[model samples]
Target: MMCDLETGICGPAGEGNSEMELIDLTAPTKKIDLYYVTDPICSHCWALEPTLRKFLEEYGQYINLHTLMGGLLEKWDGFADVSNGISGPGDVAGHWREVGDHTRMPIDGSFWFEDPVTSSYIPSRVYKVVQQKDASLAPVFLRKAREAVFPFNKNISNDQLLIDIVNSIGLNGEEIVKESHLPAAQESLQEDFIMAGRLGVRGFPTIIFLNEEQKGVKVVGARPYDNYVQALKQILPEENIQPKAINTLQHVLQKEGLLFSREIEELYNLAQQDVAAFVEKELAADSYIVEEVLGEKYIQLNQ
Candidate 1:
């Protein structure tokens, strides 16, 4: 069902135990559609969230984005054999902290220490359930779960936790709980896993693109924004887009997360001092650009 990547480990690209390929080319289109396949419990997937959000904000109009669930670490039985308990929940606490520091993303390591999760499938499947009722709510619920476990240190594997997340997001908690337990929701998740199989997806964070004719290109792992852009370009060469240059720095600062002087210098061909002054003026106007007075004049995207 899976294949081996260049590495010997059974990669999503590899056809190993999975009966399906990780990406399927059945849907044909002239324009490109990107299927972002990931699981909620995947740490790397969490790291990609901000980048993904930005990418969507910038380029979503050029492409159709779809979300899919790929089951990661389903069987806990055989993990102990090779992992020697290293892959278990008990070991994830330190790993999460290390990754949190590495990525500079705020992740509370206390979830693994306080209440470990048994499986990611439960929450992942719940995403499918929510999607059925309201497709827009799927990603919202998924992010809520991530916030609960990673930043808030709550146990998402607990039923009450899921209910609370549903409630926090202004959804009907009782209905979400009821739908999560329903047979249809489970079946939808099963189909998503099956579809992942056919697509040859081997990892947690995968973006598979299909053009109008359904030509496919797959990207794996937590890569930079350019990688995603390149993948889309490969699929949709006709869509030639350039970032618009504006007079005031506010629009650019609002669109992009942080603006380094060097980046602005390159973008608008402004001298470093001019860019610095422009940024400062924006900050003075309270236009969402703030310069922290710590070390460097850090410009933040307040919006």
Candidate 2:
């Protein structure tokens, strides 16, 4: 089974749903490993940011998370399998608009119309290179890639754009560009692709939760917060499962230097009808974070 976050729906990626199976409750206790298979340009993967952040925050102590790149779109030349015969950027842009409506995630579909990406390989390779340089910086760089494509309308496939992202993250852009072509980077990406194939992954944002015995419980799709909690409980029933309450805005601001209103809403499980207004009010009162609008309204810690 696969979960496409872009459509906020869980279904078989292709052919059959044979991969979906119940976790073995009798499995021995061991450290959980979460392999997050996703593509940079996958709108559903972008939509999963909040759920991912919450997952890491709550179960980080009990689980080890590994992000693997799933090459979603290799090329657009012969790609016509998407809904409504997606042949060009215009069709993809329309799909992104629909995803934004469904997930309530900030997505400026203008990227496809303004500066369309021909392939997802370039950014995926760049991610591998970043991981090679400094493994910790990988997540930040991935977020930058998403921001560039979805909100800023930048072509991440371009070398210059990739360089800009590297520099923006305080990394050695020149070194990254210089070694981006190294065989190791390509090998790392290939390994991810091979592993994805072995795991029967066919969609974006497919999270596989594995135990010490390598037994896995797959969570497919952009599901609600409860789905993730339930999956974790099923996998590691012996471990304490307390989801920390994000009771204050300061907690979020201090942890993540930058903040989005939607992120806060999802992180806190806020039931407020107008999450934007609530976030705006919080930002207005906070003396620590300064708000800015870059396609979407966001807050950064006042440095």
Candidate 3:
């Protein structure tokens, strides 16, 4: 199997396509470097959606982020190899049940019971194709794909579904599909796989933080906001990149749903013990955003 040198992927696995290509190191820019290694089909990736978005929204100014598409199981060809079926929508239904208790994000298990997916490559590759053409809209494409599969319950494996998402997200759907077939798009995805292999990335939503100095740290699996911040701080100790402060929390809450105590602590340097009760009181009064209980405390936005 040939390497898709353009996109930095290793091509299909199990065909002796496993080979690592060293990433060309470059001088760090004003923005901190962050790479989010993920696959479209990864359920954990879906669960990490909210935290990742908040991370981007809050820290986007300080960092330049890129997404690497790690190919999970490509097809339903090997049924036994899969814990769930690519063709059998019901096969994945049970997975939702298992993951729901783990991740607070809502997953309508009926999606697998009713609208199972057959392939994740098309949607995943579409991200590469769009990002290659217009790097700015990469996140938009990624979010649209997630919405299509996990929330809207659309089959991203199909061209029509991809087209619909493209149009819905205000992108040129036809061009995206055309590029999905293009050699350039394929190359980008292949290169992404190669990069993932070299990084020893074994799971979805593997976030790598590379500071301006080229020092790197890795966070595996779906994690909270602090997990990312801790990794980033390891690389850039000077980074005072904290969450929105309590005085400013009201503003941040207008946009984001869930808020963590650590975010406030980091962003505003607020003492967690002091602010905890006030935040809870505000939440009880309906002046804040509230979500499920994690520990003795609930996560709330400063609404």
**Index of the highest-lDDT prediction:** 2
What digit string (tens of lDDT, one per residue) describes model 3 on residues 1-303?
555866466666455444554552332234577888987767788777757766665667667777899987576676443434334557676676566446644445566655567667778789888787778677677766764565445677888888877776568998888789778877888999998888779877798888666778988998877888677667767555554323355655544434445444544445757556656544446676444332323354442
What is the C-alpha local distance difference test score of candidate 2?
0.77
Error of 1 at 56 (Å): 0.7
Say which prediction, candidate 1 or candidate 3, comes out ahead on TM-score.
Answer: 1
- Give lDDT per model, in order: 0.69, 0.77, 0.67
Model 2, stretches more than 4 Å misplaced?
Answer: 1-29, 245-248, 272-296
Name the best candidate (by TM-score): 2
- What candidate 1 gets wrong by more than 4 Å, as runs, is 1-30, 80-85, 243-303
For every model shown, the clashing-pair count is 31, 3, 14
Candidate 2 lDDT trough over 10 residues, lowest sum: 288-297
Could you give the candidate ranking by TM-score, starting with the highest? 2, 1, 3
Q: Tens digits of per-residue lDDT for model 2 on 118-165?
A: 788788988988998888889889998888787667788888888999
